[model samples]
Target: MSSPASPTIPIDGPTMDALMALMRLIAAGVTDDDAINDALGGVLGADSDSPQPAGTSPVSSAALGRSPTGETPSVSPFDAVVPLPADVPDVTDTDDGGSVPTEATNTDGQPMGLSPLEFAVLRQNSHVVTGLLKAGASVDYIGGFSCTALCKCCYSFHKNVDLIRILLAAGANPDATTNNDTHSASCLIISVVKNNVEAVKALLEYGADVSYEWKGSNALAMALDFKKLDIAQLFENFEYRKAQKNRWERYQNQRRRDAEDREAKLDALRSRSAAPTGESPTPQPVDGRSTPTGRDETRSPSHAAGGGTGSPRSVRETAQLTENLGAMDWLVPLSDIEWGQQISAGAHGQVFRVTLKSTGDIVALKRFPCHDARSREGFRREVELLTKFRHENIVMFKGAVIDADVSAMLTELCTESLFDRLERTSAPIPWPVRLRWARDIAKGMTYLHTRTPAVVHRDLKSMNVLLDGSGTVKLCDFGIARLREHTFVMTQHIAGSPSWMAPEVLRGDDFGPASDVYSFGVVLWELLMRQVPWPNKNMAQLVGLVGFAGSTLELPDRAPEGCPPQFIDIIRSCFAKPEDRPSFRSLREQLDSLLVDVD
Candidate 1:
């Protein structure tokens, strides 16, 4: 026997009126709480006797088919009211227009099937949508055309990014799609089709999958078809960002492993040193080297095992060298050194004088504060590059100490920078010393530029050229250096001190060997004048004058009286166009000839 059909539950007059008012509010996009309450209060009859709050609605849960205690009813009262065009006929009236029956039933026994959340989103009412969400509305509820709230918002005639953000924040899937037979697409794809850039951006920010396909078309392809180059580029940037993040994670993991290995080696060395002398300790192998028991294998043979034929080093000296070598195979331990006064300080790091306790070897320690992972990687790269340099005029790299908070590189200590010497003395530097200093700087630059992939010292100034106690100048500071590709290298942003920077660098152009030559010319001027470049002008004015006005440093007629004409000629050539600037090799030879004439 067939079961009897269930009786249709009728929606009350006041409930139907309140639902209709809410639909109107949603249609008008009225998300304001006070306005919504006022609209709802008029339909549901505001109680003057109770005098509710301004933003509070007088409608009770009981009016929506719940018990007086406010418990949820077996069926939602909203299910009985469907949103339709105000001028449209009821579901019962089926003309040649052929409107089908909805799932909801009004007092006249008509079915209306729209979900409250879907209706709220369709009307672009964030307030009602939030209310529905609080009332346990399903964010992913499928309504007309099998479209979810998010999908509907994406395809709405009016761009409603705020409503879409609300749905997304409330757990609406960014990649949810309508269940269309002919063509099904995600909210992102729909947003692209609608040409709503803001909606597309919101969806992507909330983790929209660009690779999602709909009817053989994806968001990327749709974006390209619509000539939305920015959106397409956004997808490419997203992929690149993901790749960079993965690469950084891998680099961090490798650094952690390397640190652990170094610690393990240190621990083994400490244990062996503490062992008794009579008993022979077992040799432990590390990096394919079997470290001899009771002796530091990393130390030179002349100083290892026992004292050499010469005078034996003191216990402190022996411990200092041995501990440093064992702790960091490629670096020395800070414990074996004593730090003196700080030499200089900058945004990311500081330089200080340090003495190696074993040999009383004085060196300059450049300490880089590891504020983030990027800085740590930069510090490591700088150390690696410095270790490979072996030029006489270039600062000699001693070793490095890599710690969690800070990393440091040790190099031969110099007495003072060329800038300091010039600033401290009133008299001009001797012509021979000046010539020798220029030659030394040129030689160092030549060596760097002659590398397989030439290294351009992007920041070359008088301050970066150091003079040892014996007056020999060595080039230092590679913080902003770049390894040239072909004959030039480009940077996204300008770097280096403005007063000494090349005109091309100031104009944000590609840097080459000639860029360094321009900076060298400025340093030469500083040496000859015994004063800072652009002493009266500020950085902005200086950059504008040098970069745009084609201005060069003024040559004083009285000063540098005995200076060779070749010196002035070299400076002039350096400041010319990039193609015309003399290479460091040519400059060095010219300086060499000038030095011979001075002698």
Candidate 2:
């Protein structure tokens, strides 16, 4: 029998030598710019002054068969290429004598079969990935394996989620998949298989296709297979939320279109009616009230007060009237407000019981001090936010006055605050009433938290909770409330009352919905005890004790009598770490269940 032929190596000798030199440089930790340049120059047959080609390896020229001056190869003793598997194809020789792998070259002419983005992700170098992106590397470039940069990062065992995020933010396709003999696997599916929750979340937030499957196994199924209940729940919740958001967007778009069409039709009708006619049409007053014209009528006292047309004696009055009428839709003119006794006064402004002159409606008017920009801004923000609220448990926003000298917000008046109710009555509040109040506050908070972008009532206290005429609780005083965003808002100084503030807020840490929950616990304690929390201590003392001394409220041996043990437990849970606090939704459910038991 004839002897079997020897197996041929894929990589050649000179290429192997250059690769070894590069490896040696990496091992020596010689990352200095001058040192790397000089070392690469020597190995790659390039002088210091030679211009390096873009995306080409340092030693590619020498690996093929050329010198720095374009001379034909005179083999050096140092060129010893390592042998790859026989299945690996030989590097293609180029006109410039650079031997790049033929299989690695894509249709876009990318060498090594991978874009800079792919190489950066494979190396798990976020810095490199950023640099490549800044240099215009395609985020969705397909590599030799037909996998995108995002897909490769997801499939990577290292799980460099930061690199994946960089790729995604650069517009990488989250739903891009890799195909094999078995099935197609998307980035999300790969992440699920790897049990990478964060990576899966990132992909989902980027609108990844959740319904994608690999061999009939979807991401949710894969998560379940791996016993990742949290991941499965996340996937399910994401899908549900996405569908709801889509429906809401469609409904909003339809409403907007309908409103535009109606406006257009009304405009057309007005234009036709305004066209020329034989008789002049009666002029209607801009204010929608009948006005005397054509010099045939006398001016009324109200007209004189508002500066009738021919009067130079009332120019200022006319300007003022025009300003009041042309103000924002939500503005309540000063002329319409009949100020009553002052309800309260603070450093920034005063709250007064005011009646509307036009409708005789009683409301609470909060006036922000003039020349104080920050206070005015806070007042404006409160007005803007409260106008969006329409919940029974939330105080109703009536209107606002935004004059330079008088900036105020008007809201529905409540009979009494919870704090005043607790203080004025010596008798213990009934357990049922306390439970009802707690339920009401939780419902209000749940509504606030469920709103778009959510709302954090940073200042939650018995003083801020009001009782309407029918004893219905309504949350008020949103001066310091924050609209929750993706990132936490940092404060230079602490906000909120010390006794009712969360420990984190007292310590000047970032406050979130959980912080509000903590405050709600303190408020609940107040309701149950019918007394102010730490009434004996001042604000400074309270902050020192609760924030720095690590002291928390303690229930007396016979405290909160007639209340269920679970209610007390819920209060205690709120004082725990923020992460451990029950959400407003959970608290609502718990309170609801307690109410059922009471009934």
Which prediction has the highest lDDT against the true structure?
A: 1
Per-residue error for 262 in candidate 1, Å, reads 31
Mind giving the per-residue lDDT tens digits that candidate 1 earns over 1-599?
Answer: 01112233344456556666666666566778887666555444523333445764333332332121223543443433244446433333222233333333444544333555656654455788887666555576443325566775676432767888888888888887654223578888887777777788888789887767776667776676688867766654554444334435545666788789999998997886786768865565543456555775433222222323322333333333334334345566556668799998875489999888878998889998755545554565566668778998889988876443236789998868899898877765778889899999999999999998889988899989998889888998886677863221122123578788787665445668899999999988876778788776544444434544356787765446668877888888989988999999999999999999988
Question: Could you list the CA RMSD of all candidates, in the order they appear?
Answer: 20.1, 17.4
> Which stretch of 10 consecutive residues in model 1 shows the poorest summed lDDT?
1-10
* Per-residue accuracy of model 2 over 323-369 as CA lDDT, tens digit each: 42343577666778787999877654788999998899999998876
Which prediction has the highest TM-score against the true structure?
2
Candidate 1 Cα errors over 4 Å, as ranges:
1-328, 485-493, 557-559
**TM-score of every prediction relative to native:** 0.45, 0.46
Using alpha carbons, what is the TM-score of model 1? 0.45
- The local lDDT score (0 to 100) that residue 259 gets in candidate 1 is 82
Report the CA-based lDDT of candidate 2 relative to the real structure: 0.64
Q: After superposition, how far is residue 368 of candidate 2 from its true place, in Å?
A: 1.6
